[model samples]
Target: MFETSLSGLLTGRVALVTGAAGALGESICRALARAGAEVVGVDLVEGGACDFVADVATAEGNRLMVAEALRRHGRLDVLVLNAGVQFVAPIPEFPEEQWDRLMGVMVKGPFLAMKAAWAELTGRPASRVLITSSVSGMVAEPFKAAYVSAKHAVNGLTKVAALEGAPHGLTVNAVAPGWMSTPMVERQLPEQMALRGLTREQVLELLLDRQPVKRLIGTDEVAALFAFLASDLSSAVTGVCLPADLGTLAS
Candidate 1:
């Protein structure tokens, strides 16, 4: 169990979070649980129910994730779409396989999950779909074509889902975080250094320099946004792309 602000913001609700094994996923799950919602954590890894263990990149996997949510909780109140990957390669050198792989997970994966959960999400009196996009989607960066493309698609999906979900008493929104200190970012450290031949600290410093706030985002902070949107507080707010990017985009 996770402890939160005791807002009781999501009391009696049930939430399903994909990519739950990851740092952001775990934080979101725990936060939802703490907010008084029973959470079903889904991932491609173990620890999450075996029934929920399916690749987000596959059709079968997306179906199973929704099925598991129904099995664990009769109704789904919130769907947190957070599963994604990052690959850094120059456009000229970018592997076709890598581009396809990233797009499949970051774009197609979330779309399938939303499609599978449509009935359940729409069935609920109040439902929400919160997708984790990135600043890369909003702004262009070097050597991140695949990642940027997928994120842009996610934003587009969020807008469409918002329009579709509104009639069903559901809201769809996205959070675009800049540089959160998560394992996702860490995973690219060595490759980043090798590519640029810069130290880890230097890489981080360069990233921070671009941020107007000059700080990395926190997982809990991102979770807090999800909690607010998933709850009644943001009922009227939908189809919005919120930047949790430490003012990076503002600059």
Candidate 2:
């Protein structure tokens, strides 16, 4: 495990990460834990390594997450709005239910998560909120209307919340990742292959061709950014969407 010299940067703090069952989310939880934060991982399913179970798409579920965290850890210092699902389909043919599902989990979930916990975040000194956004938040792509729009909404939420939290010493920011090395991206590959009528290799190349870095960004790399945003080093940083993208937006 690669450790930063600034290990334990989040000592004496507590963090809550949603979507903690997924690959990227797990990486983020582990990163924050290693940085000395009492990481509380939340997810809906009963399995896959999260500390709590709560559906982020519902108001009640989000409220329970805060309650559970406080019940165990006493106070919240960092909140990572990371729970989400990926949808792939052409716009004209996209299902309304799928759109609602994506928006519910991606956009509304963050809003509810923040709403339920903002007071707790602002209650502590040097608290922070990090939203896991995507390059789609900044740019568009075929068959990604729902996911893109939801991410865009999150970026806006991050900015507005940053302004509101500034006077209270709470920092809010987002990280817009490019192609991530996660199961969600893996699952979408076959869909992309069929959608674009290309082979697996072709689909891979198509997805990566625009990224100047020429490779999928790993969950660990993205988690590192989350760790940084969660730590004291990022006390002055807020309301900005940092692209851990491989220059995807630059091109």
Candidate 3:
């Protein structure tokens, strides 16, 4: 419903977004493109918006994607580490493999991607590295130990990168969003219902209860925030995780 245009904000800039096949990642790619940035979308599987199909969890994949983006665009200005995966289970019953997989995709992926893009990003006058963190990064949630841990680590990585990038005119930051109306959240509903022994409606109510907004967040809402952070307007803002949690953090 937000109709404002962000055109011309990132003219001549090239942005690379991971998890480009997912709802949030695809939306971010579109948003950056709308802002006049040439976007290179990377994902494990091919999607309509994905320009490169690569697993973000591997160092080789990360390096390849960054190299491909630079090859095509000739310069990289924004690196958005938005790849993520979710597994829901009580900590006692959680599978160690799942935990490792989540960490690899979320935490390790971002770190490797950032490392791979560092030289190209720092070579520019003003570049940005944005990580997709979660409200779980700041707070805890049940049946999501891996997700929570990965997000927390991502926040820490963002701060460290911010400090190191400051002297090079590169900014690093993160966005922590609450529950959004996306396929990922939809998939969680069945797991949450079974875990809590509640109906789908009840599970929905439980999720909304944490936020005062009484509704799920829109992907575009979060993508717009990323666009702002990727632009010159947010040059002074770095080393912080901005929340788009619909008052969930406030309450």
Candidate 4:
């Protein structure tokens, strides 16, 4: 991160990013790649959108993911747990199965990934784990019971990892982003419309209302923050949840 430019900032480090099929994940992969890291992308689709494909939500799949990553690159310098799923519904009506799947993907998934990558990560002098938390992790919202809860768990996991990895010189952190202008966020508009009986524009406004900047976050913007966290420049910034929420946290 101390480099004069983004290019070659990562130099020889190798990064593994999950949920590479999504826009944000792909952008993150590209960003780290541009910064000179050999990025391996993991996704659910078989040979789909990333360098590697696997179901990150399962323990077996995560074990295999780390295996393949190490086989390919021989070292795991950075691990980005960005895979996620969303199911929005009022608490009273929220399906138990949906809650299970959401937590599986967002919480257990990262736990497994970290567990599998621990040896490889600690083998090196410096390593990083970057988890994707959300603004919902800090502030709760209606119809987002599962997401908020899982993100909150992610924050807890990040802090715990930071403590355990401190002696090993490994840093763990979370990037808590607000609503974004990505397809994943767009897909939720209809759900909101149906749940709240609001028009698409109205739903968008409501989602953006908390952010004084009044604009959806860009994937590239989040990627920049990830790059910083992945680099040595942020070595002193472990066990923290940094927000990329366009002034939302201010309000």
Q: What TM-score would every model get versus the actual structure?
A: 0.94, 0.97, 0.98, 0.96
Name the weakest run of 10 consecutive residues (lDDT summed) in model 1: 45-54
- Evaluation by TM-score, superior candidate among 3 and 4: 3
What's the best-to-worst order under lDDT? 3, 2, 4, 1
Using TM-score as the measure, the top candidate is 3
Worst 10 residues of 3 by lDDT: 1-10
lDDT of 1 by residue, 1-251 (tens): 12546369899898888888888888888778778898888788865322256798888888987888778778889998888788998899999999999999889998998999899899887899999999998988778889999999999999999999999999999989889988888888887888888999998888788798877788888888888888998999999989898888878
For 1-251, candidate 4 gives per-residue lDDT tens digits of 32246787788999999999888898888888888999889999743248777889998889988998889988899999999889999999999999999999999999999999998898787899999899999989999899999999999999999999999999999999998878889899999999999999999999898899988888888988898899988889899999999889899
Residue runs of model 3 more than 4 Å from their true location after superposition: 1-3
A best-first ranking of the candidates according to their TM-score comes to: 3, 2, 4, 1
**Tens digits of per-residue lDDT for model 3 on 99-126?**
9999999999999999999999888878
Clashing pairs in 1: none
Candidate 2 ranges with C-alpha deviation above 4 Å: none
Per model, state how many residue pairs clash.
0, 0, 0, 0
Model 2 weakest 10-residue run by lDDT? 1-10
lDDT of 3: 0.94
Clashing pairs in 4: none
Compare the candidates by lDDT and give the number of the best one.
3
Q: Which lDDT value does model 3 have at 175?
A: 100
C-alpha positional error of residue 218 in candidate 2 after TM-score superposition, expressed in Å? 1.0
Q: Which pairs clash in the backbone of model 3? A: none
